[model samples]
Target: MNSQSPQTVLSGLRPTGRVHLGNYFGAVRNWVRLQEKYRCLYFVADWHALTSDYADPSKIRQATFDAVADWIAAGLDPKRSTIFLQSEVKEHAELHLLLSMITPIPWLERVPSFKDQQQELKDRDLNTFGFLGYPLLQTADVIIYRAHFVPVGEDQASHLELSREIVRRFNNFYGNVFPEPQPLFTETPKVPGLDGRKMSKSYGNTIPLTASADEIRALVMTMFTDPNRIRRQDPGNPDICNLFQFHKLFSDDATIARVDRECRTAQIGCVDDKKLLAEIMVENLRQIRARREEIDRDPSIVWDALREGNRIARQHASETLELVRKAMKIDFPELR
Candidate 1:
């Protein structure tokens, strides 16, 4: 296989079990489209998962598989993209350590997510070195591949900027070996949950991408609409309604226009609108749902694809590590 995918795009996802509609529309779908245009390396960031969920550590293995199955089900073809588990490629650890030695303590602390995550997961004991240094590890994750682009949402561009700074610092000290990765900015749709909040699994308000038709129907039926529209005759505000946002994603253009127009005129009720969305969601998800089930029946297919990706990624990682070793003056052949 060609190891050189010019202008390569590297990205990974921390295992979070099956993905919800928010995950699919906001990111995974963009990953699928990316495979068609660039040489993409997609990985399961299992090691990154430990940064927060180290207490239990039991769910990582299963959640990794669940996430990959959904990734394949959503359209991330193994043949088109290099898909592997991050831990399987050990070179990442070596490079991460090398970067950490030169990185300043203030650099890691200043990363926005550092304090933000600690506050969000306040219950967890996050004083460990792993949590503080995870951002540097992320720098390793991208630079190890010398990836040129990393697909990220608009809000996440700042997070990727730190990786660029670290890379520039490394190059200035050790000579330039890695490119400053650019953000492949993408359009992310804001999907709402059943209770009118942002759709999230933690919120217990997600509709999974692999949900069956019946399950989809039940979930959508409970979705919140315009709260002020109390009666069938009362005019509704589609802009404020949560289900209307979903309709924009799943429904046809004509239906969306009609719904918007009639919603304000009080011609269409919330129940009827939800019923329409449920059917549309079921239909839109039918192919992915079937693919996910087929992948579920034969888990080996997913693992086999991942194993091939592992082989490909390790080759690239080994080459990069050698360069890093030479650049850092750590490659002592006599010792070996």
Candidate 2:
């Protein structure tokens, strides 16, 4: 916390199942780029995951390994970025508890996503204390390290405002023990699933980064396109087709241009476009699979990286807690 830089970047992801294409384009891919220029801290948010999946936690350990493996596969160099497990660092929990005491109840209740998720995930009883307090935990995750930037997409930038507000309020009461984290807006693409929905594991529509070429091909074949193009001869509106969006991201300029023109002119049928995208997708993802296989061969690489990062993070976090405790007159020197 003492060496806090204006360039320090902090972000994290939940330990869900396999890392998917949606997860790649949405966060990890951008994180890969961030590590090159900033002192980045990217962690597996296992403690945060408890907010919802507390009832069934059997998959969390495997999920954490899979998340770390996929992050490495997607080019997060442990040598460059600090990669740690959230639960391994006790300071995060302590900071969250301290912040909660000062953060107003109305402030947490007013977070837009708080109510949105509750209404959406009605199947799960989210009335627990953790569900409402995760945002505060998120704020603790950022300002505890006095992070300067949190990489998020443009639309989601407003979400950081809540964390910023908490930081301002906390610094006001506790002295400038933290820095308000700002959103480093990144280019996040909208990755749709095979069924034309947002690509999500919840929808059973995610293409995991570790998916085989054959599996990708099969998924691509099922990809939804313009419903208006009901026939092979029907000239499709590439503008309205999600598969064309895939072409833009995965295919080269010439191929993307060709697909755009051919689909418009009815020269390329849906099947042919799917085949082309499948091959291009598989080719682009080949290196990632190879890297994942190599990393998984020595499972110690993933765990070792976390071990070293946890050590480093623990040192910084302990120092930050000391500053926090002193600012609030809570560091009991007698106990030490």
Candidate 3:
């Protein structure tokens, strides 16, 4: 990635499905805030989605809309950020092809997530060129925006390292057109699902951001609480309760303290505690739902925004690609 002020940041999400509360607090909130301080490029990673779940991919189109809609509603300002789609810009694929030539096979083979996901999705046949080359595409996505920083969790640090190494190799051969991007680590909270597990769609344990008030209420009703406090009269352990964790995020600090005090003393019953959490969740979601409805009504707004973004992305990426072709001696004199 090329960095102008050395503060440009790029990151993206695959258009998989409806984002959940976990997604909101974990990644989207950070992107929303980072846009104010940094040069930001946020893209819908529709191409990356094909790495694993290429089969039955008709959902990608709908999922992309839902994901982008949620991003706009969650305060990602398009005026300050370059929001684009990966497939819309052909330069990304061109850069990916170029980077793949320089990227060693062992480098891609050693990507931890690649192998882990291959085994995890063993039911599907993973023997494909696209599956192995997705990380190279990821590198292209980051560098095309000339991003100096990539916000990621601890687990993703290795991929950033690999991208840095690829950048070094490319610069060694070609002229210096890209910078080695670094990780901007974020401390994402442990958001548990209704099943007392990590919130994930695969586990059928996500609370959808667009879930109706009644649906959220029903899910909250089934939320797991302290197992030791089976009886309403029994003293509960808020420390061990997932709903308590949620309360800490959604409820006022004073209410959280009271919930802690009352629960440990057997004053607040589990049912009432869950009901209170449900109310807070519903209240917070009301504005998000309204924002989404407004955006949905004018579907052209998203398309128009994306079209403008594609224009910006193509211009920026073409500049880099032109320099790359010159460095690699691919551009002809007549073409130039």
Top candidate on TM-score is 2
The model with the greatest lDDT is 1
RMSD of each: 1.8, 1.4, 1.9
User: Quick one: ranking by lDDT, best first?
Assistant: 1, 2, 3
**Candidate 2 has what TM-score?**
0.97
Select the stronger candidate by lDDT from 1 and 2: 1
lDDT of 3 at 322: 85
* Candidate 2 vs candidate 3, lDDT winner: 2
User: In candidate 2, what are the lDDT values of residues 32-137, reduced to their tens digit?
Assistant: 9999889999999998889888999889999999999999999999999999999999999999999889888988888877887788678998999999998999
Which window of ten consecutive residues has the lowest lDDT sum in model 2? Answer: 1-10
- How would you encode candidate 3's per-residue C-alpha lDDT over 58-81 as one tens digit per residue? 999889889888888888878888
Extract clashing residue pairs from model 2.
none
Question: lDDT values of the candidates?
Answer: 0.91, 0.90, 0.88
**Candidate 1 wrongly placed segments (more than 4 Å):** 1-5
- Residue ranges of candidate 2 with Cα displaced over 4 Å: 1-6
| Candidate 1 backbone collisions, by pair | none
